[model samples]
Target: MSSHVYVAFDLGAESGRAVAGIYDGQKLELKTLHRFPNTPLRLPDALTWNVLRQYAEILQGIALAV
Candidate 1:
């Protein structure tokens, strides 16, 4: 049988990461491809996430993974 491979992008409140996984018949092995910060910006009035920047980070992570 052929091997199973998987790629995952895990986004969290503090950061994001790209992971690659290999699956055997009974177990799975995972490896990290890239990780970037996602800390929100805190201002006097509010806290916000820079979505545009985060998107750019995602693109970067994808590029690095490839």
Candidate 2:
């Protein structure tokens, strides 16, 4: 049997996480690969979501997947 892998990212109000789904010939499984805090970045002009940091964390999760 062979296995397939999939990754998903979830960004929420308080936090963000990366999840992995593994499917074999007959079964599927889910696991949380990484998690990070989602906070607003306070810039001089306006507040924004820390997207760059989130992106980095997502990459980290992908690295761990394989």
lDDT top scorer:
2
Model 1 CA deviation exceeding 4 Å by range: 1-5, 22-28
Model 2 poorest 10 in a row by lDDT: 49-58
Q: lDDT tens string, model 2, 23-66?
A: 99788899999998989899999989998988898899999898
What is the clash count for each candidate, in the order shown? 0, 0
- For candidate 1, the lDDT comes to 0.82
Q: How much lDDT does each candidate structure score?
A: 0.82, 0.91
Clashing residue pairs, candidate 2? none
Model 2 C-alpha lDDT versus the unseen true structure: 0.91
- TM-scores of the candidates are 0.65, 0.90
